[model samples]
Target: MSVLVVGASAAGLTTAEALRRKGFRDPITVLGAEYHRPYDRPPLSKQFLLGDWDETRTRLRPDTMLTALDAEFVLGDPAVALDGHTVHTTSGRSLTADHVVIATGLTPRRLPGPDLEGVHVLRTLDDAAALRRSLTPEVQVVVVGDGVLGAEIAATVCKLGLSVTLAGPQAALMEAQLGAVVGGLLGELHTAAGVELRLGVAVDGLTGVGGRVSGVRLANGDLLPADVVVVALGAAPATGWLEGSGLTVENGVVCDEYCRAADGVYAAGDVARWRAEDRLVRLENRTNATEQALCVAANILGERQPYRPIPYFWTDQFSTRLQVHGRPSADLTIAEGNIGERFVAHYRDAGRIVGVLGWNAPKQTRAHRQHLVRT
Candidate 1:
């Protein structure tokens, strides 16, 4: 029962470890494109970007620890092909296994702009390092997008003594993920941090001089002068290499409730789009990465386990900690509080509670999640 895992990220590593722990003593191989060891990505925009943490501190398992798991390591080579039970790598290497797990994760979505020197997108370690080097008090940063990644980069750059202006196409920042009520609250936080918030605007194009970005023009004829432009528009699944692999690929690789794909193949993490109750869902967070990987490992060992749970996600911007419980929809109603110091918002679907968003109120949110099952 040999297993081959594509990607050495959180999902891949967790699946490998879970398989080993389940007593499947078959040969296992982990392939990664990154030469560096498997490292944590959550801190790349927060601590690592601000110089509060080092690259060595973000690793989930160092090289020595990964070797102890008794899995074959193939670093610096990306899996370029998936044919039945075999994987072909970019380094001219081929691997055959009884089972394969695709946990390729995601890549940043690039925007149309002039080829400039001081532009960046924070997804990997190299992106963070390059962006950090350009972070100084003298740099004026124009951050494109207001999602979690964009907000974090904006907050970090502001904390680093750089002027920042956050631009987003939506009326409210992070409105798609965090409903308008919470999005409005976050807007206030960014304002408090001295981050210029520009919403409901679209970038016309980028203007540069001497191969360096100078400023961005808006459709409204307004221009934002920036020394550094960081595009944090969000991410798409890194499944381009799997083209024509006979897998159902939408926004991600579609899988079943057990995380199984076609012909002994499985997928987890940001790359796996599995069936939920009403729809096929793909979560690009660590919680889903770990949980889905565990379920995949168990099913591979003939345990016949099914992955089912409420979706969860969290974000931190300065002192504000926003936590979301359960899957939410765009039409969900929001309940607000006075003063807005601490608020608890409920997301209802068909007159039943489906999600809850909390700010400085964990006890209420915890109780709410517990009651969801009972109600």
Candidate 2:
């Protein structure tokens, strides 16, 4: 059976590779919105932004590997709309397939404000390159968001010895994701790394002069001056083109447990929000991208397996590297090591371990993951 993948990033590429490995020798077409071939996105915030890695070094696959897949890659042309198993591109090209997979990923959310030169958001390679050219050790930078993307950008900028202020509504860094104890500790870490914290306030809007952003205005009538401003306010799923495609689209493209949105049509990665037993769930991490695609590929080949994976994510800031398995909560206790050093924190619910976090202690975290395996 012929297949069409409406994304060229991690999930889309993984799905094609999985399908090939599963012995499906049908024709495959991979569509990409960006001009660049599939590249790793995690490094865009840290390594690429810091100039530690160049553009070619960030590619997810080499030319030789892509050639071996033998799939036609239509780059620089974005899928503008979908009708059944047919996808229409911006170049007015229409292609139909027996099976269609949507792995369109996400688009970064921008703050609503006037058009300014210094304002930026990082989602694709072009965004990172544009932001990098403005970043210098001398310029005052302001990152508006307290989540993972904002925190990572702030940490990387501070490492360059640049003046940066993290503005957000959370009392501590990543409070919603890391909880009170770990989030408070992360706040201290950023402080130790020379990043100025402007927390507990909502951002009003952007203030600028001569069409260039000058500072970020907060709800409290305080303005934080900035020469370069990075808006890392998270992202939304890229499902706008599927609006009238007869697919259930809410926060994302809703699907069943098998990742099928409709017969002969499925979704994976950040774009796919599927039912997992009781509630609808969607994961935006790299691990889920691969796992969900694999499950989708298997189901497409008639295995009919459900996609139910325990969410996992990690982040590095300053000298600390954190790894989390399953869902962690604020009710945490020391499972191994100590708070001031490399330690493992266990999050329990109803006296049962639900998640495990390793603060610079990777081995201990894996050992504790067994406790949450049955969860």
Question: Which ten-residue region of model 1 has the weakest summed lDDT?
Answer: 330-339
Superposed by TM-score, candidate 2 places the C-alpha of residue 46 at a distance from the truth, in angstroms, of: 1.0
Displacement of residue 221 (Cα, Å) in model 1 is: 1.9
Best-fitting candidate, measured by TM-score?
Answer: 2
> Which one wins on lDDT?
2
Which portions of model 2 show Cα errors greater than 4 Å? none
Give per-residue CA lDDT, model 2, range 69-177, as digits (tens): 9899999999999998999999999989999999999999989977899899999999999999999668999999999999999999998889999999999898988
- For model 1, what is the error of residue 287's alpha carbon versus the real structure, in angstroms, after optimal superposition? 0.6
User: Each candidate's TM vs. the true structure?
Assistant: 0.95, 0.98
lDDT score, residue 269, model 1?
A: 94
Prediction RMSDs, each to the true structure? 2.0, 1.0
User: How badly does each model clash, as a count of residue pairs?
Assistant: 0, 0
